[model samples]
Target: MDPRFLGIPELTTEAPSVAVVVDVMRACTVAAWAFARGAERIVLTGTLDEALALKARHPDWAALKDGPPAPGFDLVNSPGQLRSADLGGRTVVQKTTAGTVGALAVRDASLVLCAGFVVAEATARVLRERAPDEVTYVVTGEDGRADEDLACAQYIAGRAAGGSPDPAGYLRRAAASRAAAELTQGVRRGSHPDDVALCLELDRFPFAMVAAEEDALLVLRRYDGNP
Candidate 1:
């Protein structure tokens, strides 16, 4: 089946068998990096408060958020930060402005996955392997105006359809996006230039980030084709 790209707000308009939430500017990229750093799973939350509260309850899990780390949180939601941190297989509780909200809003998808350029090809592979009749790519930036997320979604969609999508073409569009510029504005809005560079790397990870329900909480874990 062909893949459908939808803005985060339009998720409720249709029920998708598989929902791939794209947040290329940072959130999903951070998730991908966290896994690479040995984090066990990420608990997706809609609000920073929820992530903080969960962290407080566990006291062992890391709390990651967009912008600077909150008082009790472990680190900022940047792939650069996760790159240096050793999670020791601990769970991460994550909250972001767009990615987490869009991911949590998906109500009826049988499978919900997180995607960014870093995990683009792996995500497409998951979609192809699952062979779901309905696949929706949720652009989780600026209600879909964010070019980085849109381009990544298009690339993944094309690949999931068994085509060899042009990564250079998609990279050009994503790098030129306003979202990409903002992340490189030198600590503006708690974003860093390193993050922009890191998030734009294509297929940096070889696994998809799958968000699954565990004990009534949405948890994201590395998925490498196994159900």
Candidate 2:
């Protein structure tokens, strides 16, 4: 069970048996948390217009952007705030800088899973059960390659292969990564201290977020990784 890890979503070439879309900075992480909190389903979009359009069509679904809270959106792209959100039986429409877009782009993957440190172990557990011959960890970056996303891919793949990489070390490296610096400079939600830590909290969630296509849109659902 060898798994390939690629940095930058645009560079993904193969349609692996399984594609793990990793966005450690915030997007995928918060989605996992949302599902665990009882959100019915989440629609992920790469473009803000698509997200807005989806929300418009489905007024019941909450809408949010990738960064800070803005007008007409139900939430911001902050894990810190999502941890306390009332997501019970509700659906959310989200547009992130990368994760959702990457998941949608990889149409060849038989199984598309969104993951972060919070669900890393559980995701590994689920992947091991599926045991696809080819797996690609697609790390989404805001602009180019992001160290934090790369670290997340390494951790997820390592855990799935029964190898334990240094979690503390990975966190340390990510904290000082170019992605972190850029987020801070850009004043994005990833810049918040709590938001960063929330994304880095390894294995905090017991379920992996799986994407299923419905009406040509990917909606996320929680899959219990443990028996």
Candidate 3:
């Protein structure tokens, strides 16, 4: 299958057989890890209020919104933030800067998969098994263009197409990009250099995260095989 990596806020009804949303720094990264570690299901919200409202209705679920740590959330949208949380049996309600928004925006996709380097190989396997005629990888940059997201898109698309994609080389490019500069320079709102480092780890997991809507809530589940 030929995979096309393109920017967000733009996907077509004639898009592709599958749409893989990439946000390496680090909304999708956090989502993949959250599911891998045994969170019941993650509900992706488009805003903080929506996430909070869901949490209010389902008090047992964990919430991760766009801003700072809220009143009753087990975690936030940072991969580093999720590392120490005990989310063994909880549900996570997440609203991020880009990844979740991109997931919801692409109504044209036959299948939507949330992606990062953590699940690139498995994602490729899933896409390969399905063998879609065309696959579109949406580089869901944080509010705008993000170097990390674009790099991950390249890595995942290259791997899915049976090529040796250099994630390390892409990582170098991301590190030198404007987004990284903002994070390191405190020009960006919700990130630090640690966040930059967290998202750069390539292909960190063995499974792909397939996004499916269950009961109107977009949930990302771990799929070790074909979607």
Candidate 4:
């Protein structure tokens, strides 16, 4: 069957056999890098309080939390933060408004894979291999309506179904809007610009992360084979 697309806000009800969580503006991308750098487990939460509570409980493990500046978390949902410190043996707990919440909503999925532009190819490979009865691409957004997330979702769905999507078109539109937002808001955002570049970087990583509910953490590695 062809893959299906769903906005992150719709995930709570329209569950699919396999759900791909897209947080292109950097939560999922950063998580992918955390695994690459040898992070043991990543706890994804929707709120700062939840992440901080987890961190307070697990003091031995290193924790990193990110969200909008107003909420005042440890990180700011930028992939740049992932490179700041070595997380060689730590467990990173992440909290974001859209990404983490979107992920948690589909906890019952047979297969749950985190996705972003950076790991699009890896995500597609995993979907092709699993060949689930149905595939749902969930795009997490800031206000249930972010252009970049929708563009990335469409790109992934198009690619997995043997169809072509205009990656440049989506990137151009998203990039221009983000650049404009930066100038007007003076927010000096890091995730969107870098994320737009990162998402377009195809197959830079060989593996994808799969969430294991029993373990409450992502199981990092490559999909075994193509379906």
> Which clashing pairs does model 2 show?
none
lDDT of each: 0.85, 0.78, 0.76, 0.66
TM-scores, all candidates, are: 0.95, 0.90, 0.90, 0.81
lDDT of candidate 1 over 1-227, digit per residue (tens): 66778887777755677898999878899999889999999999988788888988999998988887559888788887678899878999989889988888774578998999999888888888877887888898988788899999999998888999779999999999888777776644656558888998888889988987889899899988746
Q: Which predicted model would earn the best lDDT? A: 1
Q: What's the distance in Å from true for residue 9, model 2?
A: 5.2
The lowest-lDDT stretch of 10 consecutive residues in candidate 2 is: 184-193
Per-residue C-alpha lDDT of model 4 across residues 1-227, encoded as one tens digit per residue? 46666776566575578888777666777787777667777777666776677777887655555534443344555665565657777777777667777788787788888876667767777776666667877777754466767677777777777666767886665555553355235364434345445544655677667765746543333342441
lDDT of 2 at 95: 86
Clashing pairs in 4: 117-199, 118-199
Considering every candidate listed, which one attains the maximal TM-score? 1
Candidates, ranked, TM-score: 1, 2, 3, 4
Q: What is the lDDT of residue 6 in candidate 2?
A: 72
Q: Could you tell me the lDDT of residue 192 within candidate 4?
A: 39
lDDT of 2 by residue, 161-219 (tens): 88878788778777887766666576665335577667778888888888878888888
| Model 2 local distance difference test score | 0.78
List candidate 1 stretches off by more than 4 Å: none
Candidate 3: tens digits of C-alpha lDDT, residues 1-227: 77777777566656566899987767888887787678867788777788888889989888886546668665766776677677888889888878888887763467888887777788888877787888888888844367777777777777777888656798788778776677678675545447667666666788788777788777777777776
